[model samples]
Structures are given as C-alpha cells and as structure tokens.
Target: MLSNILLITAVGLGSFRSVQSQSTPSICDNSTLLIDSRQVLTTAQECTAVAGDIVIQYASDYPATIEFPNLESIDGSFLSINFDEDIRVTRLSAPKLKSVTADVYISRWVNLTTINMPVLTTINRVRLNNLPSLTSANFLSTLESIENNYEVTNTSLKEITNDKLPFAVFVEIFDNKELEKFELKGLKNASYNVALRRNKPGVEVSLPALKEVFYFEFQRISSLEIPELERVIGHFVVNDSTVESLEAPKLQNVGLWYDPSISITNNRGLVIQNSGDSESLSFPVLEAVQLDLVIRNNSALRDISFPMLRRVTGNIGLEGTFESVRLPELDRVGGIFSLGNDEAGFNCGDLQAFKTNGTIRGEFSCPRYQELPTRSSSIGESEKEIKDWLNWASPSTGFESFRSMGAVAFAIGISTILLVL
Candidate 1:
C-alpha cells in the first residue's frame, strides 16, 4: 500500500515537470514568430494570435497536422518555407482564417499534399511556387479579392477555379505540367496582363465574361474560348500552339490609341470558320489599327476579311499563301501596303487607286515586281516646266475651257487633252 501511494505521487510529479518544461510566455506580444526546425512545437495553441509576421519553416521533425482554429487575422505576412526533404506535414488547416493583410508565400514544401483554409477571403498578394507534391488546395472558395499579383508556377496543381477574385493587376500561370483545366468564369477585368504559357497540352481555358484586358498572350494552349471579351488595350498575341479554333466574337480593338499591333502566327491547325455561315478568319467589327498589323506564317489560313475596317495608321503586312483576301471597305492606309505571296491572282488595282489618291504614304510591294512601274513620261522635263504646266491647267482654267465648247466637242477635246498630258 505504501509503494502504490509513492508510485502515484511520482507519476503526478513527472506530469507536472513535463508541463513546466514545455511552457513559455505567450509569443503574441512579439511582432514575429519564427518556428524553426530546432524547436519542437508541441501544440499550435502556444502562438494563437500573431500581431505581425508568422514564419513556419525548416521543421526537421515536423508534425503531421498543424491547425490554427483561432487565428482570425494576420496583420503581416505568413510565409512558409519547408525545405526538409523528409518532413511529413500532410495537412495544414486554419478553419477561421478570414484575412491576410499582406502577402502569403507558400513555397518549396516538397512533401506537403494539401492546404485547407476554408473561409479565407482577402489577401494582398499570393505566390505559390515549387511545390511538386502538392495536389489540392481547398477552403478558398470564399476568397474574393487579391489586390496585387497572383502567380502559381512549377506546382502539381491540376486545376484552379476562383470566381470571386474578379480583379487583379497581373495573373500568370505557367510551367504547371499537370494542369489540365483553368476556369475563371466570373473574372470581368484585368488591369495589366494575363499570361498563360507552357502548360500541359489539351488543357482547356474558359473565361466566359471577361470583357477587357491590357495585354493577353497565350503560348502553347490547346483551345481558347473568351466569348465576351470586347477589348484589349495593348497587344493580343497567340503563338506556338495547335489551337484548332479561337473565338473572341466581341473583341473590337487591339491596342490603345497610341500603340496598336496584332499578331496571330504559327498556329498551323487553327481554323476560324463559322458553323452555319461562310465567314472564315473574319474580324467583323475591327475598325482601326493605330500601328502595325501583321498576319503571317499561318499555313492553314485560307481566307481573311475585314469588312468594317476604315483606317490603318501604320503598315499592313500580309504574307503566306492565303486563298482569298478581302478588305472591301478599307478607306485609308497611312503606311506601306506589302504583300508577299507566291500565288499570283491578287489584283493591284485597288492598291493603285489608294496610291493615286495619296492614301498610302509608303511603297507597295508584291511577288511579281521588284518595284512598281513609274509614270509613262519618256522625254525628260525640267522641274520648272512641270510646275508651270500644273499652274496653267488649274481648275478655273479647265472649267472655263469646258464651258466654251459644245458637249460632244468638249468630250472629245477633254479626251485628247488627257492623252496629250
């Protein structure tokens, strides 16, 4: 009986010693909490509310689960850098995390599989990189806004769909090899650029209601569908892909009023044919180009028609062997009109009329000509004589001469005069 009582007392002392050894003053008063590999975090309750930054990194003997149920807000950054190759953190959950006032950078977690923050809604910036084994990120459905930049690169994330993050300055998703589907259905505008490059083949992109962006570029995407996109204030370039079809029905302007250019090149299998109509590769409402317009190196391109085009302030460069080219309503071109094609059926008369009207400011070149032919004046005339003749045959003189002759005689006389001039 005495031995049993002594054993119970000893057990109580040991429990008290363990608690005393692991206890410390609350770290909430400090602005930064650095959870390093050397210190073993027994429970997440030790540091509940951090006034500033929280860095959880390099845990050599990391726990399997880390939960911060009471963390409501982080006033500064939350950065996690897990560089330990053998650390085993399977899940990180913050059930009540509502906002991060600054950046959130989660990178290089080589073995982390999932991140769960269900009610997180606001963040300033987010960058996720080099997490190869991470497959899922959950509880971010309530996220509404990212103020600056959101970039995800070199991860194993298969898909991302964020409806509430409607506006961002720059969004770049690249080098995610297993990413197959990306849907930002509710995204309305991007202030700067949205670049999706070097992703997996056959991946689908759906941005249904996106209306405007400054710059939009796609490289090596399988298919693109932005049905309601109306304008791009900068360049819109699609290159180095096998995208079979591109549909941006409402896109009207490419560049801003200052700088304008559009390039759709090297998409060999792209076909822009309407289903029930005969229009193929058509920009129906594109009315202006303030700078260069280049359409080249597309092998499967057969037809191009710009019906409502009224003016181009720069060069109009057309290459490759297109079957038909139609610009019926093109009224003015401020620079060169160049055509480089092996096929010889394109008529140069319309361009000649533009040249004669002084609409094209630069030379026009085609496959058949080293240079366009000059005026048919064999005998050399001095510059002064040409000026004198132009002055003598003014509009007033010509009108007075026509009034003095009979109608039939006047027609014959004008014809003879034109031939002599």
Candidate 2:
C-alpha cells in the first residue's frame, strides 16, 4: 500500500510539473501601441485563427494598451476586438473564443486612456499583477467585460468602484483583499442577481436599483443605502458596522415576507427610518411575516407603526423607542407581540378604536373607552332583540332557546312591545 501511494504521489507531482513547464510567465513591456480593448494578440495550441501573411506572435511582456490590427482570436478563445476609435465596438462578438482559459494582459500602451472591451461575456480569470498605474477597470463597459463567472485577485486595486458596469452576474473578488470600496453606479440599469460578500474596508455598499437580494452580508460597512429595494429573496445580514437606519420604499419581506418562519438577528445597531416625509408606508399584500423585529438598541427611534399590518409570525420588539407607541390601524398579529420597556412607560391606550383582530397580549391594562353615538330606547330595544335572536341561533342549547324567545317577542311587538327581556 505504501509503494502504491508513493507511485500515485510521484505521478501527481510529475503532472503538475508538466503543466507548470508549459505555462508561460507574463512579462511587462512599456513601448507598444496599446489596443483600445486591452487584449494581447497571441497564438498557442489553443490558437484557432493565425495571421495569414504577417505571422506576429504575442509574448508575455506585451504592453497593457497594445492593440492588434488584424488578429482575429486569441488561442481559439472567445475574442472581441475594437478596430475603430469611436469609443464603441464597431463589431463585438465572440464565436470562436468559447471560454477564457488564461489571463491576458496589456503591457503598456501609454496613449490608451480607457479600454472599451464590452464584447466579452465570460473570462475564466483575469490578472492585474503589474498594473501599478491603472486607476480603473474602465475596459469593463456594459456587460461585455464581465465573465459569466469572474474572479479578480492579487492586485494593487484601490476600487472596484464602477458606477456603470452593466454585467448583471456573480463575481468573487477574493485574494485582492486590499480592495476597499465598490461602487454600483453603473449597475443602476442592470438587474444583478448576485451575492457580494466578504470584502475588506472602504468597500462602499450602495444598491439603489436592487429589487431582489439573496444572502447579502454587509459586515464591514459604515453605511448601507439600498433605497429602491423591495424584496429580499434570502438571508440578509448587516453586522459589526455603524449603521444607523435601514429604509426601503416598497420592501416587504426580508426573506419571503409571507413565510413567517425567518428571523432577523445579531443586528444590534440597525435602525429603521421612514423614507418619505411623514407619508405613511404601505404594505398592501404583506400577509404573514416571521422574524425577530429587534428594534431595541436603536435609542433614536420615535415611532413603530404598521397601519395595515396583517400578521407577525415572530417576536416584535418595540423596546427602546421614545414616548408613544402607535399602530392605529393594525389588523392582526399571529404570534407573541410585545412592547419592550419604553422610557415613556407604555402610555398606549389611544389606538383602541383601530384594533380589528388578534389577541392583545402585553400590559394591556389601559383601555381608553370612547363614547359611541346614543340611540333612542325603542331602537335600542329593537337592536337588543335582533342581537339576542342572532346569539340564540348559535350552537348552544340555552342560547338557542333564548333566540326562540327573542323571535316570538319580535313578532308580538312589531310596534310598541318595547322588547326588554
């Protein structure tokens, strides 16, 4: 068994060595006419279409800005080329380049200001090991430069801060751990179905056009502004930051608003703020929600109101707010709902007129009564008789007899019987 293991290990090492020997290390070149797309025209066994007459092969030290005049594809990989200087690709499509097998580099085309490479849909990997002077990934335009699956690592990048890269896909920026801020300004038009997590500091988190967010972790941010968010499709975690308030315009469920089985936990400093100026927030279709609504540590909060609220499937925490607790038009509550220890001492007897359904379970000892409109004695007696008849029709034996008596009384005193007992 030991000999067999050693043989397998030696074979594995040999294969790794063979692959390493074939791999070409990229070198830096400064003097070259950099292409506007930043792709190096090179040939390999992977090369599909070589130049017919001028067989100029690319080397590892090619400049980052060097452009190819007649090169069609790189090593049979899906390639996009921009021949014109119109700042947009005249012809951008990748038929031969199916997937990027290796990372291509543009050495140093000094005249090149911005690389417009939007025809690329997917790249296996990208390397920025020597781009010490590069300030932006401006080559990424629209959705073309983004791989269907992209990985950016090992660089001196200060920002993935593109306000406008429209590639709506998943990206993992691990290994480039020094990257601080990521801006989603260009992503405003994109419907990104993504999971962005575990980035280091200065990572600016802003998503105004996001509608559906799944398993998002903003663990290292000071402020998160997602104003246009409506639905959360998965678990949302906002922790270990100085976040003051969370506001969403049409936001209903953090994870399936109707599920009533999810929880919001470990967010000790999250504060919820109303977006509009005193305009009541509305959730018309929200049915049942299950989560710990922990609004305790937010001492600056004033009011917690769910006017048309239907049901809560978890613990509702209204512990550490200001004076008054008001939900004047609450319809129903499904689980244990409580008002935590308020500094104003729970002076909430004003909403009695709006309680439609649900068990009142807190220190509901304060019941503020409102005097209803009075009616004449005869009308009251008639209404009492009708109520007695309805109750008697219920499934209780004694009550049924009472209803029968009420019906007889109603028949006898159609005018002046003044039905009392």
Compared with the true structure, all predictions reach lDDT values of 0.60, 0.37
Q: How many residue pairs clash in each candidate?
A: 1, 28
Model 2 whole-model lDDT (C-alpha atoms): 0.37
- Candidate 2 stretches with Cα past 4 Å from truth are 1-157, 163-180, 186-203, 257-290, 319-321, 342-344, 348-421
> At residue 287, what lDDT does model 2 achieve?
30
Give lDDT tens digits, candidate 1, residues 1-421. Answer: 9999999999999999888655533564457766665343444345445688877877657677766667777888878875777777777777788888887788888777788888888989888887887787764346788888778887778897787778888878888889887777777898887878887765678788799887677766666778888777655666665565555667676654421122322211112221222123445666655444555555655555665555554456666555555655565554466656664454445445555555555677764333222232333432332233223321110111111112111000000000011
Question: Which segments of model 1 are wrong by more than 4 Å?
Answer: 1-25, 38-48, 64-66, 82-87, 139-141, 257-282, 332-335, 343-356, 367-421
Leading candidate by TM-score: 1
lDDT tens per residue, model 2, 1-421? 9999999999999999887655431211112222222243432222233321212233334444433333233432332222223222212222333223333343232223343444443443343332323344543423334434433444445566544454444444443445666556544322223433444543556766666544344544545666765554443444444454444545555433322122223221112322122112233333323333333344444444443333332334444434444443333332234444434344433433222222322222222222211223354543443343223311111000112112211000000001111
Worst 10 residues of 1 by lDDT: 410-419
Q: List the residue pairs that clash in candidate 1.
A: 118-139
TM-score, cand. 1? 0.70
TM, every model: 0.70, 0.44
